[model samples]
Target: MTDQALPRVVDQATWQHELDALRVREKAATRELDAIAAQRRRLPMVALPDYTLTGADGPVRLVDLFDDRQQLITYHHMWFPDAEWQCGGCTSFTAQFTRLEFLAPYDARFVVVTQGPIGEALAYKEKVGNKMDWYSTADSPFGADMGAGPGEGFAVNVFLRDGDTVHRTWHTDGRGTEQLTHTFALVDLLPYGRQEEWQDSPPGWPKTSTYSKWPGSEDVAAAYGPQGVSA
Candidate 1:
């Protein structure tokens, strides 16, 4: 970290008093989020028609992604046509899907779906975490219909499967998936926010464009951290 302008140093009592005020607002915001979630759960669901999606295991039905589970949460991963790489923002977001075994006990399945070829999707996992479950939507409109072709960006689709019926419960776009990154939340808590140009950092604080510092080569990972979680 470099020397930069910092929030004014304060006395212990003054710090506590300031923290107390923020805590009240934080509590209220948290409750509001909880209420929002309840409403999200109650939102109407849209049925998905039978469609094909390719995985490392070859062509498979969309329902197969559910893995005999009643619920499936898929990250609508973005891919480039060049077949050499993936979107950095998508990489940063999908990295959190690792170690999500906790979803299994609850009968939920998580997957990353891409419109690129299966080979590219598979190569993505190899460059990143080989353990990640990545799929290719191929020529199928399954991804576009479910909200992938819109902005050439990404989304998170929540689904509920009952017998042969597949229902889309909730879906969130790129910005909506921001909460998946615990690291970003941690960064927000710091005096300097993300140190990225897109963020409104104070003068003298480090800043870079959100898309800057991307890995120059497809094989190399971006500098999200030493652990390979690309920002």
Candidate 2:
């Protein structure tokens, strides 16, 4: 049978109703995952050590970036100064960094660290109108120490600090544009949300629309506007 003429396993109404039900199930699953995360937050904490990174005013220590806070979430953008262009994926990720203030109440500070020179990093941040603090790991070996250096793989690593000690808490390296969705981790517990996009759909069910092809190249920045291309 041709693709469009496949056997009708279920009628349209039944299929849509099932899709709606699946969406509800996915939302329930996400809620459970969030509750588990809340429990994880109450786990025992560890002290963090002080580490310094280069900033506009010269070397600014890690403790200073924390601003006396107990936790820090660094973006660790992949900005090899000499590269022809910044990492397109990293560029997309930084574009979403506009909502940095929303993360403050979580008792953590967010900052971006790049391997580019102070001038280049500052220029990119200015171009994008970034609200978060930006730093350059060019001078010190901080990027290498943090596993954010070129070829070591990319990830979002969360660290905890108390007094003068720092400890790694969590990290995630989602693939593709999906990786650009760290903020989505906080999506609400609604039936028609996330993971639901891929849930079961009966025969003849229409596919969900998307912004771009999955894991599209860095060149798809036109739709992302200046936010994605600024860097």
Candidate 3:
């Protein structure tokens, strides 16, 4: 285990060959994922249930939020009223929000649903400078019906609606999994990088840090309101 006796990984020719093989595998994986995505898109539509939810503009119909867009992506942000603050992971992930604007040409709309009041939702959006559309379920039952209320967990669910019919195309509620897809996925394909310094990063790549709760962190409340922040 001494330094001199350790294997030399930095100067190995085999390493390059292994990297090449990995590149091929990555390409194949990408192709397979694209095919599966196509299948999801082709799935048949279902009737969109009647639902009303709070919006920055006021109480609004679920279908109306579609804004005539054929595809809608909703992020069920953990924005409960009594909750202290928004999820930090969500805050970080939201750095990718502006990218959603580009999807407009494809007839896709992205929105975030919060359990907080519309004013609260708006405040958070302003504080974070998020350009994506945001709505609240504070005065309505939409979040509960969508399984996005308190205790419901964090998720991003995509729905496809054709006229009055709606179909849930996909749902992802897992941690950090959102980075795997979206226009961001396309960006990650570029040579410069995805910028996420996860464990799978190649050698010498910088790793990123996850936020840690420190002493008195609970005292810091969300500026949205007295109860809007998290511990």
- The lDDT for every candidate, in the order shown, is 0.77, 0.65, 0.66
**lDDT of candidate 3 at residue 93, scale 0 to 100:** 58
Structure candidate 2, residue pairs in collision = 47-165, 48-162, 48-165, 48-166, 49-164, 49-165, 49-166
Q: Top model by TM-score, which number?
A: 1
- Per-residue CA lDDT of model 2 for 1-231, tens digit only, reads 545424347999998998899899999989997896797676665444466778888888877777788788777777754664566666656666666676668778878888788888877666544556788877777677777774454557677876667777765665532434764455323333333346454455444554332332244344343565443
Ranking by lDDT: 1, 3, 2
Report clashes for each candidate as comma-separated counts. 1, 7, 6
lDDT of 3 by residue, 1-231 (tens): 543223246656788988799999999999998998899768765555767887877878877778989888888877646554566556545534556667789998888887878887787666655666888877777677666776567787778887776777776677545553464566556543454545355565544443332212122224222454421
Clashing residue pairs, backbone N/CA/C < 3 A, model 1:
197-208
Off by over 4 Å in 2: 1-16, 35-49, 176-231
Error of 3 at 61 (Å): 1.1
- How many Å off is the CA of 157 in candidate 1? 0.6
Candidate 1 residues 43-93, lDDT tens each?
Answer: 999887998888888889988888899999988878778755567667756
Give the local distance difference test score of model 3.
0.66
Candidate of highest lDDT: 1
lDDT (C-alpha) at residue 16 in model 1: 100
